[model samples]
Structure formats: structure tokens, C-alpha cells
Target: MKPAKDWHAAPLPADEAKRLRQLRSLALLDTPQEEVFDRVTRVAAELLQAPIALVSLVDEHRQWFKSRVGLDVCETARDVSFCAHAVHSESLLLVEDAHADARFAGNPLVTGAPHIRFYAGVPLRSSGGLVLGTLCAIDTRPRKLTPAKQAALCDLAATVEREIVQREAARETLEVQEVERRKLRVSESRFHTIFQRTPTGKAIVGLDGRFVEVNPKLCEITGYSADELMHMTFQEITVGADLPADLELVAELLDGRRTTYSFEKRYRRRDGGTVWIDLSVALIHDDEGKPMHFVSTMQDISGRKHSEEVLRGYRQELERRVLERTRELTSSRTALQTITDNLPVLIAHVDADLRYRFNNQVYRDVFGVEPSSLHGTTVRETIGAAAFEHCLPYFARVLAGERVAHEGIVYEGAPNRMWNATYVPEFQRGEVAGFYIMSQDITETKQRENQMRSEVMLDALTGLPNRRALAEQLALSIDAARDAEVPFALFFMDLDGFKNVNDQHGHDAGDALLRQVAARLKKTTRADDLVCRLAGDEFVLLARGITSTSACSRIAQDICRAIARPFEVGQSEARLGTSVGIAMCAGGTQTSAEAILAEADRAMYEAKRKGRNGFRFASLLAEVAPAINNLVDRGSATRH
Candidate 1:
């Protein structure tokens, strides 16, 4: 608490430059007072029983107060500033009485209003180790701070230093967030422009024909705000005369009978006005082919309907014009080129003759040809004969007025990826015309699913096959023995002294020991053998084509010896043993995995009962029991 010996407050001009730079970098000068800094000053004043306390920063030409308890002035000239001397000092500046000190004996601050007599200031350093300013206590009457009070004042200064540095870091974070907001604004602007392009109403509808998202354009067409529309379904606002046909098409889209279908419909708006709109609807699906939502665009078509009514009075003159419009309808289908071309999925239409009629941009990206250039090409010619023949049957089904959604087809054109596709039959005048083909690449989804399945079969602690994997292999082995009359052996093993090792050293060390044992077991077994951990300290090995008594017995001995070796556990070595029991099967009529496993388990305990590290054979097949007995009689019992 007392100032260190030989330490004096001497203002160095060279150090002042770096100190002032660090002070300004905090951006705390000439600002309103903050409560974090004010709280510390208040505590310093109360604990010391002083009249004035401040968190003062030394600027280039002035000493500014960031937080002041009783001081009236916010700043003072640097030459007359008492805190300026503490800004470059490694230790605090403690002046018992400014009037008695030779440095400030005749200073103006000692003779003027609000005169200073006692000053104790501690340097607040930046994280870069440059002193910025001081947390000071002042009184008009001469006094001295006790050792405990000096220590308390230093602790308060440390609090102010922490707040200074953290505020600077927070400012940097705000700058980063501002930049991210600017980028987000630009993205939103682009979306707004596209959303308002040509559609009078745009929305994302749920499977139940309820609005999930409605753009402002839709809100304008209907007299309801976006929030009010959310609670109401599209069917509720539709004119009842047009409701049945609209519901029918929606059903067809949901049932996979069509990828997309558009029709003119009338809506009963909020004011009870009938507004006709050309509504284009398409269903969106997840990676598993489940419907997620529907994206719909509605364009005002009240004028078109009025024109149709007038044209019906001049039927002969309108015949040629009607044929031209029919051609456009057959080509553009709802004029959805803007939407379909932007979609990530591959979409195309084919005629009854299997000739490609239309395709979106994704088709060109996949096939390496312009979609327009491929318009007149047959499906077989564009996809090549091999892929064409594979899809021919599905095309026949679609052309027969059936909808098909397939996920198992391995398209030769993209052999490295999986695909999900929907074929929707396009009908004209009660006959099948062609179909719309929509496909999406689903390689990543399938890969993730396969990874999850593999993790389930693996032991997370040891990276060995787990009990589930062992059960699968055991089933296969039993079926092979029963049907093909082949023979196999199952080894039931439990590590000796493993529990004692865990109890003495801890579970973490036991896990380390188990991983080492698993590595050794894998090395000892043959490549065709299956090694897996059942649960804590219990393991199973399925060794195929090892039915001979001597072969199976030697295999068990090798496994026992492998596990008997000392394992390096943490900083120490742990010694453990194994008790192994072998169940040999050679195509007996009563051979079963459960019966063999139980017999092997009993034999394993028998080996443990005889001594810890040893192997015993329980030949479950009646044909092999006699040979196994002879081997036992030949003094072939192994014990380590």
C-alpha cells in the first residue's frame, strides 16, 4: 500500500506521447460520464472519507474527468493538472499536501478557488501496458491515506481499467454488426424487387391451403393486413362458385398427380368484391419427398375474362385469334418461366411422342446443351439409349395417365449421385398427352443418413463394432450354418481384473486400457473373423470356417495371450487377463445362436473358475464333440 522506495513521480516527455495515444484510443475523453466509472469513484470517496474523487484522463493538452464524485470542473490545463504526473508513472502519485510539496508549493491550484491540498492518484493502464490516466482522491484539507485505504483505492482503479478496455472491444463488435446489417439490407432489396415484378398477389401456402407467407402485393389485392390473412385459409376467401374446381386441382397436386397446375379463380375480397386472378400453384417438397409448403403467384385476370365475354359475341372473327392464344397456352402453360427458371430443381415437359417440348435452365446446366436447342429432340436421343431404356417403363406409366414418384433410380448420366423424381401426366381432352418431369439431386441427404446408421453400429469409446453389429453378424453366421451346412465358431471373452483396474485407477484409465485391448484383439484375429465389444469388458468374436477342434482351440489361445499383455494406462502400466470360451458349430439340427452363446458363456466362467487367463471349448455341434473331447484329453488346456 505504501509507495515503493526510490519510486518518484517524474513526468517523462517521451513516454507521454505513447500514454496520450493510448488514452485517446479509448475514445473516453470529452464524453458524458458513465455509471461504471462513476461507481468506482463513489466507492473510493466513501471508503477514504474524501470530498472529491474522479476518474481523470490525460488528454494531449488537458486533464478531463470521465467520472467525478464532487468536482465541479470537467477539465483543466495539463501543465496545472495533478493527475498528469501519474499518467506516465509506474506507481501512484501520493502528495500529502500540494501546498507543502516543492513541485506544487506555489501552483495556482493551491491558491485558487476549489483549491487542492491532498491528492492521491493511481495510474490506470491500458491492456497494452501504457498508463492512460488516474483514479484520484482529493480533499481541501491536508491529510494522508492509510495503508489499507491506499490498497482499496488501487483496487478501485483496476475496476475502471477493466471497463475502459471492455468498452473498446464492444465498440469493435458493434462495427462488425453494422457491416453485416448493410449486407442483409442489400439482399432484402433484391428480394423486394423480384417479389413485386409482375404479380398482383404472391404467397406461400401450406398443404391445407392456408397462407404461410403473403407479400405486400397480396395484401393490397385483398383488403386484409398480412397478420389477419395468416389466421384465414385461401378457401375461406375464394368465391364458392370457383371453390370446387380449385379444391380439386389442389388435391391432385398434393397426391402427386401433377407437379404444377394453374387455373383462373375468383376471390371474395374483404369488401365482398369478386376479383378474378390467374393463380399459378406449385408444391414444394423436402428431401424425403414430403410436402413442405406451396409457392403460388396470382396475377390479376379480370380484364382478360371481360375480353373473353365480348369476343364470344363475334365467334367467327375470333376463331383465328383463339387458335393463336391456344398455341401460347400450350407452350407457356401459366407463363411461369420466371419462377421455374430460377428454381434449383430440374424441370422439363415431354410430348406424347417422347419429344422434349420445354425445359428450364437447370436442364442446360446438367446436360451441357442449351435447353431451347433440345426442344425438338426425343427423350432417348437427349439422354442416350442406355438411360432412355431405363426410363422407358416409367414414361409408359405416366403416359397411361398415372403419377409416379421414384427415388431408387440410378441414372447412368449422373452415376455418382442419387435422385428423387416425380412424373406427372399431362392430360388433354380426356386423353394422356405427355408428362412433366421434376428431379432433384439428393446425394448429400443419403450420405448423411448412411453416416448416422454407421455410427449406431460402432462403439464410441473404442471404435470397435458394438453389440448391435455383433448380433447382425451372429444371425448371418447361424443362417449360413443352417442352410449351407458350413461351420463357424463364436468366442465369448471377458477381461479378468478389468473391474479392479477401473476401481483403482478410474474409469478414464479403464477406457484407455479397453481401446488398447481392442487394437490388440483386432491384430490377433484373422481378416475374415468379426470382432466386436458386447458391453463393458465383454467381447464376442465370430470366426467363420474354423470348425476343426485344433484350429478353433489355437485361435482361442492366441486371443487369450493377446489380451494378457500389460497395457499402458495413463502414466502407469496395468496388467489384465482374459477368460475365453469357444462355441464350435458344424451344422447340427439344433444349432441356435442363443443356445451356443449360453454354452460359451458358461464355459467362459469355467475358465475363470479354474484360474483367470485361460481358454475352454464347448463344441455345440454333436459331430464335433468327440474330436473336441480328444483334444481336451491330449493335455491342451491353456493357462497364462
Candidate 2:
């Protein structure tokens, strides 16, 4: 205790004192006794051998005890405490005795409870030169301190300052650690949310390949429960074929070659089917930068895989078919070219514009040009307008889908060659793409045609000339038949019940039966006989100059037997019979060979009406014809 001059009065700068009070107010004053505070107080008390020691904080109104040994309740009023004076003074304050020193003689602490008589206090300074407070010791009896003890106390106060600094550093470190811990908690929450909510399956894996975490999506993809998956390694669930590749990718991630790796793999389900998955793997590192675990994301890609495979197969198949078609088309094109080149007839094709699109070698040769030069050349340009006009009407009719056929001579360009030409329409996509023209050089055919026209008599079935060569012949019959006249057969026969045959069987069967009969008749006839298929199985035979009727009868009877045979019509058996009518010019009264053929045709029907399968005489038809068309032209009359 001391008698103080006005307590706030001090020799320090007013602002410095205010700042020092602020510094001291920041809890250098009267704190709870702890190791940091007590260590300094205890050392000072022991070295000084005083009854009490204190590290005090002096505020404007009170001296507060920061650390004290042997002091009670931690504080005293500023007016009564000697340490308050030590705080304002930069140097030490010492009082030998309050009773003996007039300055503290009237202090209540010396006259009242826990009276202090001897006191010494040294000012404690902060690093900023603020007087924080004092390190002071007290005695109930007047005492003196040794110099060493005094110095030791000052050193102990400096140690307390250093302890405050160290304690502050510890507190800052604890706050930093707390903040880091909170960040870790937030990051963990975020990671968990992402793992569960992502569309793909995600997992953490141990180095031993066990799952540390497997999301619901992972469970679904693998077709395993979470509990089941937890007991199995990824190797056991992955398809065997995909395991090796997966291992390689995992190795890359674990080796730090990549932080993340991705690949497509298959996972085998419990039912033994496999699901395709796209896997992305990443390595997680520990604080020390060592591999801690693997994190993987799996995406189901079965649909995509199947689509790609199917599309790839379709593409490959389409390419194969395309190649096959191209090869076939090429072969067909080459064959068509060969056939066209070798054909004797001229062939040409023209487009919508009447320009030659394609033409055979004959056409090119007839026009006196290379085949290639004819392409895209109009008929008028290539052959002059006169030839084009002659062909234009046929072209127009063909373009209108009308089939135009004409047999007349026309002179082509280049050497004035004449041809009998015909044009056909070629359709594409239901429209006429072009015209196809064929022409034959008829310069020699015309001569043959003229010679054929001179002989008016012809085989009724085959439309070839028949044996009118006898009377119309200016030479011997045999020579006239062979060279002077194109003598052919007029075989006269009747189909027995030909009407009933058509009725009993269907028309299709009857027609088929007739065609078969005609084929057999053609086979039986002479190769040069000109076998004619007449209507309703009535055939004529001009057995020209037969050596005898016996030979002709044998031939006719053989044909009759041939017609009596069985035939197979579709799904049924059929039988046919015939009657023969013999007609020949072997010195008969008929003047011309036509008279004999007319008689035989009439006699054949008569044999059919008479009990069939029997031959009849020519006199019967001559008798019937007079009543029928009266101009029967009996000039070459029939003789019976």
C-alpha cells in the first residue's frame, strides 16, 4: 500500500498511458492461475525468498493480479497498492516500510487486513514499449532483496513474456486445425452426395481389389446385392475376357501414369449373362502423396454396344452384297457386249433425244464409224436427215408404248446399204428410256422372198409351199419338186372326236394334247416334208409322186397307229385316235397338184364321220364340195 499522487498522474505521455491501459485491458490482468502464469510467479517468489510474489496488471482504477503466489482474491484497489506505481514508472519502486516511509504511512493495506510493510516492484514492458504492469513481491516484515535475487526476478518476468507469446502461437495453431477439420467434413459430405446421386455406379476399392464403397447403381449393374458385392473382389464379378484389359488400366492409374483411366468392360451377372459397362478409374492419394485407394465409375453401355455391333454387321453385309451385285453386273455387261458384237443383225439404242446411246458393231460398221463415235450422236447427224425422217415415225410410236413393226427396205447412210429394220421400246421405271432397233440386210432375202411368192400353193399348217410342182412344173417332177419348186408336204388327217376331246378334257389339256400330237406328227413326217399343224388336228399330206399307194398307205397307217397312242396331260392320262386321207398326184385325173390336196382335206373329215380310224376316198369330198361352195374349180377335178 502506498500514499499515491493522483493515481492517473504520471510522467509518461498521456496518449502512451492510454494506449498502455488498452494493452493491459486485453487480459494481461487477473487471469486464472495456469502453468504459464504460475511458473513465473513461483520462480520469482522462491528466488527473492519473499512471502508473496505477483505479476500484476495495473488498470486506470485497480491493480489486477495476473499471476500470484500467496495472494488472495487476485486484485487490489489502485490507491492502496504499491505495484500500481511500478506500472506508471519505467524503473523499479521499492518501499522499506510503510510505517517508516511517509509515502505509504497512511495506506489502509498496511493498517488493515493482510498488511504489507516492505515492498518492491519492477515495471514489466510489452514489446511495443507499453507498461503492461509489474512483477512485484511483498513481506509483512521489512526486508531487503539481494542483487542476484532481484536480477532473477526480472529474468523470470521476461520468461513470462516469452511464455505468453508461445501460448498465443499454440492457440492460433488450434484454430487453424479446427478450420481444416471442418473443411474435411464438408468435403466428405460432398463426395458422398456425388457418389450416391450420380447416374453411373461409383465405388472405392482397396489394393486387394475389395470394394470399400459400392453405390446402388453398382449393385444394379453387377446384379449383386451390396452385401454380396462387399464380400467379392472386382475380379470375381468382371467377365473373364475383360479382366486382363481392366487390370492394365487399373495398373496405369495406380502407378500414377494417369490420375484417371477409362475403358469398356463387361461384368458377369449372377445368372451368367454379362452386362457391358464403361469404366472410369482414378487413384486417390494420401496426405503424404502415396496411393491410398482406387475410385471407379461404371456406366452401363449394353445398348450402345449392341447397336454398334448390329450396325457394323449391317454395313459389312451391305458392302458384301454391293460387291457381289457389282461383279454380277460387270459380267452381264461383258456378256451382252460379246453377244451384240457377234450378232449378224444390226442393233442400236437411242435415248429420249434420239441420240444413239448404244450400238452394236454391225450398226457402227454400216454407218462407217467407230462404235464409240456413235454415242450421243443423233440419227439425223450420223445418217443425214433423209434416213432420220424414215425412222422417226417408228421411234415416235415406240416412245408412246406402241409396238411398231414394219418390213420394208430402207437405205442406210455411208454405202447406201438397204436393211429391213424393226424397233422395240425399252422401258425403265414405267417410262420409255429408249428405243432398241434391229435391222437385217435383206438385199439377198428379197430375191428369196420373190421366188417364194411365185409358188402360190402352200402347206396349210406350216405355210410352206406344197406339191403343186407337178402341173406347174416345167421340168420333171422329181427335179421340179427339188429345185424348180419348193415342193413340201400337205399331210391330210383328222383328230378323232377332236370336238369331244376338247369337251371331255379342259381346253388347256386339249390344247396341250393337240400340241403333243402335232409334235409327234412332225417327228413321223419326212425332215423335208413341211409338216403343217392345221386347225383341230386336220393335217394334209401331198405325198408328191409316191412310188406306189402301197408305200403311201403304209406311211399313212403308221401315222394312224402313232396317233392312237396314250399321252400324259398334267395330272391325267389321255388317249387320241386319227383317220388318214391319202392325196397324191400319181397319174390321177386331177390336172394339178392342188386338186389332190383339196380332195384329201375333204376326204379326211369324211373318214372321221365314217367310224373313224379308217381311210376314205377323194371322190367323197369332190361330191360334197359341189353342193358347198359351187365354184369348187373342178378344172383339176378329183377322180375316184
Candidate 3:
């Protein structure tokens, strides 16, 4: 058994003991071998003209050799080793002969191993005067060390101390690095969790345009599997025509010129369709401050793009029509004649007797007469009395010197198509000369106008009826409900936790999620049901003819589940749960449409307060309840 550690083996000051502990904590007392130490020991041995030189670490009960130039063993017991006592000395410990030295005369190592005869060692001390170990040179022959040789030996030991400090510093740095690596690993796991499951597309792109990392949403949006997208360039999935001229922006980022860029661009969907995406890109720089690569977020904007296109078309059409009308009104008579003759507008003249006089080719052809025959013919003579009866009042007003202008009526003598006509009484010297008729073939125009009016009532983003159209539908529905004495439910729904996606991802992703929510609502509701968008994430559903509160509640649950389904947008999967408000008409109660809509909206807010992703049916019960019951019931039934 080794003797108990001698805490008071020597008289040492408090500061010196503290520093000695620090030096010991460096863990160099018993260490492995290395070339820097070996070289030092080798040089020390050669300079001292000794057979052996050692860099030794002294522990409590043993001395461990870090490097021994002429010795084969790595360590020895403290009872036999000279370095064990050398560590206690502040300076060199010289033993001229271990045989004569009482401390080693009975040591088994000195008698058996390469016998250490002449020994000199210097303490390896820290800056604070803590002796950790020794660097000693050994010789086989008994000899005394010279003063200069002793000094050189001390310097060499000091060099060893410096090496120990450098090693300790390097070890501490390695430990710190290991701790940082562990933290980075945990952070990377968290990042993966967010990247793989987030609701928006995310990617790390190389300077060469290759994707270093891509989220699942990106895989879904591009129609390629996640494995496939990872090996591809961003350009591979990008539609070439839609690629921006500033693709060099990525290069600039790599060259340290820019930090971030965002743009609207198109990507080729897996199904070979084009999907519009708004991309936000940021450059990642290395430690040297050179841009290494880029990280980007992609959001789907196909619906918004479609809405923008429709709005642009409407604006352009309005502008074009305004310009065309301006030109027609400002041009000369010859130009007018040319336009009227070539265009679908019908133009002609009638005399005070309602006779077809000056007429364009269309008028001549419609009247089935030459200009000579129709010039002086009366309406009764040219078109027959039946046609004459339709326009006699207008002609009488013109003949009485009153100018007439109206739409929705036209009269042609021979072959007249259904036309919308405007009649103006031409004046001559302050008296009515004859009627100048301008008619247009507006059959296609009327059809298109009606179509546009219907479309304007629908939400372009969701394909649901918009608020304007909902008002009309509600009014009509209310009338039918009143007549039949039947009650209907009005449900207002708002998605839960939807704002976070907008904040973290972007507006484009938010819009896409809204569209998906709209689709889910449509799918969950009955086909006959009318769902309307009240703008900005608000929806109103009229369960056109519901039976009871329970029935309406069932529909609301369905909606909640439908919305809760993962929304795979771009490169991310997001869950936008719903909070629904339900208000059922009292089956026969007389209430305004506005009142019902407001009640539904209020209830929806109540649902939001009771924790989102839930439903609140309008009072009999105003108190909030745990939504778990409803979710469980819904889950069981809908699972099939």
C-alpha cells in the first residue's frame, strides 16, 4: 500500500499550493509520448554528453516518462525513481552516484535496469512556482556536473516547462472545442427539425448554384423527391424563361458584394406545370468574410400571380376601351366613316318621315336596298309597318325637333340582327335634320360583361364567393328561407396560429396556406353549400339548409380537421388549424343578413379565444369548453 498523500510533506505557501494544484490539473504529470518532447530530450542528452536524457512527469506514487532519448521503459515506481524527489526541489538535484547515494543504493531499478550512476535534474516549474516534474540527464559513469553544464541543464528543464504550458493550453483549447462541437450538434438537430417541417421552402445553395440543403417543402413543390433535389442545382428546377438576369447576384454574394436578395420567379413543378414563387436569398460568409454560399426561402405565389394577371387584364381592357372611344370621338368624319364601315357599329341616317337616307354598307345591306332606293324611303315602305311601329315614337320625337338617345332597341328595314342602338337626332340650322343611328353588335360583348360581373363576385385567391357576391347570395337565400320557413346555419371560420407562418416564412407562404385553407373548406362542406371569402383570412359558409345545431357543429369540426391537415407549401409543411364560429338561424326567425354574419363573426372570435384550432357554436352555451371532446368525436367519425 502506498503511503497516504502527504499534504504537509513540505512547507509550502497557500498561493504556491494553489498554483501547484493548477499545474497538476494541467494533467501533464502522467502523459503519452510525442516528437517535440523526444527531440528536446535527444538534444539535451547530446549537449550534456550523457548517455540518457528524459522528460519525466511526476505523479503521487510514480514517475512517468514523456520521452526518454536513451531509455526503453516509459515509467517507474516512485520508490526507485530519482525524478520523484527532484519535483520537490526548486532547483537542480544532483546525485553523483546512485550506488553511494543512500536514496537509491537499495533501489531495485538502479540495480537491475540501465543503472543510473550520475544524475542531475531541474524542477519543471510553472510561472507561479509550482513544481510539476523534472527534465534530467543521466550518465552511466560517476561524474560531477560543471557549473556551466548545470546551468545549461536548468535552461533545458525550463524549456521543458514551456513545452508543458503550451501543451496544456492546446489541451484546454481542444476541450473547449469539444464542448462547442456538442452545442453545435444540438443546434444542428434543432435546425433540422425546423427545416424539415417548416411551412415555407428553405435551401442552402452553393456558389455554383447547386443545392447543399433542401427542405421537404422544396421537394414537394418541385415534384422531385427530397433525395433528388439535394443533388440538383437551383437552376435545374427553375424555369429558364423566368430566371432573372441577376443570376449573377448569387455570384456577387459569393464574392462578398451583397448580403441578401429577393425576387419573384417561376419554378417548374413536378407535374410540368409552372408554379410562381417569391424567393428570398441570403449569403453565408466564411470566417475570412468571403461569401461561401447562399441560403434561401421560397414561397408559392401562383394564386396571387393569377389574381395580378386578372387585375392587369381588367385594367388594360379598361384603358384600351377608353383610348378607342377617345380616338373615335376625336377623329374626322372620313376616319369615322372608315371606322363605322369596317367596325361592327351600325351607322345610318333617317329623314323626318323616318326614311332611310344616308347609310353605311351595313345599313344598306340590312335594309336590302341601294343608297338611291333607301335615301328617300319611309320606314313603313322600307321595313314594313310592324318594324315601323317599334321606332315610330322615337322618329316622331326627332321629327318634332327633339333629339333622341337610348339603348336596347334597333330597327333595320330588311334583315336586322338583335342590336343595341343609340339614336341621335342630327341638327341642321338649329332644327332636327334627321336621325343618325349608331348600333353595335353587342351579343358577345353582353355575354362577356355578364361573365365578368359574376367573376367579380368571387375571391380570386380561393375560388370562393367574395363578400360582394356573398351579400347577394345571402339576400337571395334569406328570401327562400323565409318563404319555406326553414332555418340555415352561417359559419364564420378563421384559422389558428396562421400569423406565425406569415411572420417566419413570408406573405407568399401565408397566401398559399390561405388558398389551401380555402380549398379544404370547400372540400369539407356540402357541394350545395355556399362558402364566401370576407377578405384577409375570413370565410363565411352558409350550410344552405342545415337541420340542427349539432348538424352545423359537425360541419364545423370537419372544417377544423380539413384545415389541420398539413399544408405542404414550397419546401415546407405547415399546419394552420382553424377556429370556427357557428350561428344557426332560429328556423323561422326574421333577422337581417348583416346581423347573422356579425353574430357568426363574434362567435368565431370567441372560438379563437378559447384556444385556436377549435369551434364555438352560438349561444345556448356562451361558456368555453375544452375542445378535446369535439376533436375526439370528430377524429373517431372522420377516421373512416
The numbered model that scores best in lDDT is 1
lDDT for model 2 comes to 0.66
Where is model 1 more than 4 Å wrong at Cα?
Answer: 1-329, 333-338, 352-355, 376-393, 483-487, 545-547, 585-592, 610-612, 629-640
Candidate-wise lDDT, in order = 0.77, 0.66, 0.71
| CA-only RMSD, every prediction | 27.6, 58.2, 28.7
Order of quality (lDDT): 1, 3, 2
Distance from true position, residue 247, model 1, in Å?
37
How well is each residue in 1-640 modelled by candidate 3, as lDDT tens digits?
5332211122332244565566677776556787888888988899889999998866656678888988888888755678766765646899898778767765665665787788899877653335667899998888998878887887787678777767666777987788788986854675588687788888888888888777878787778876687778888888887666448676655554444566888888778898898898877666565667788998888887998799657644543453355346534656654555664455666776677765556766666666456677675776567656886777777677665644445454533345555566666898887766666555565567679888978888878889968877776666666667676888888766677688778999888888888887888888989988898888889877786666876788788878888898789888788778887765556555666787777777656543457777665233432353355334543553
Query: What 10-residue stretch in candidate 2 is worst by lDDT?
Result: 631-640
Model with the higher TM-score, candidate 1 or 2: 1
Residue 204, model 2: lDDT of 84
Off by over 4 Å in 2: 1-194, 333-640
Residues 1-640 of candidate 2 have per-residue lDDT tens digits of 6544222323333445665555544545545677777877888777778879888876767778878898786787777777766665534577777678765766777776668888888776643335667788888988877766665666676676555545445656786688688996754675579776888899888987998778889988888987798899999998888899889888876765444567898899977899999887767766576778888889899997998789557544543443344335545756555667776776677787889877777766676788778899887887677777877788799989875655564644644446666566767899998776666676775666566755446544444434443223312342344444433223478776566567778788777777787778777767745454445556654455454444655677678778878888787777777876655443322222334556676666555433356555565235443343222212112211
| Per-residue C-alpha lDDT of model 1 across residues 153-205, encoded as one tens digit per residue | 87788788778767766777886687688986754664477555645688878
Give model 3 RMSD, 1 decimal.
Answer: 28.7
Highest TM-score against the true fold, candidate: 1
lDDT of 1: 0.77
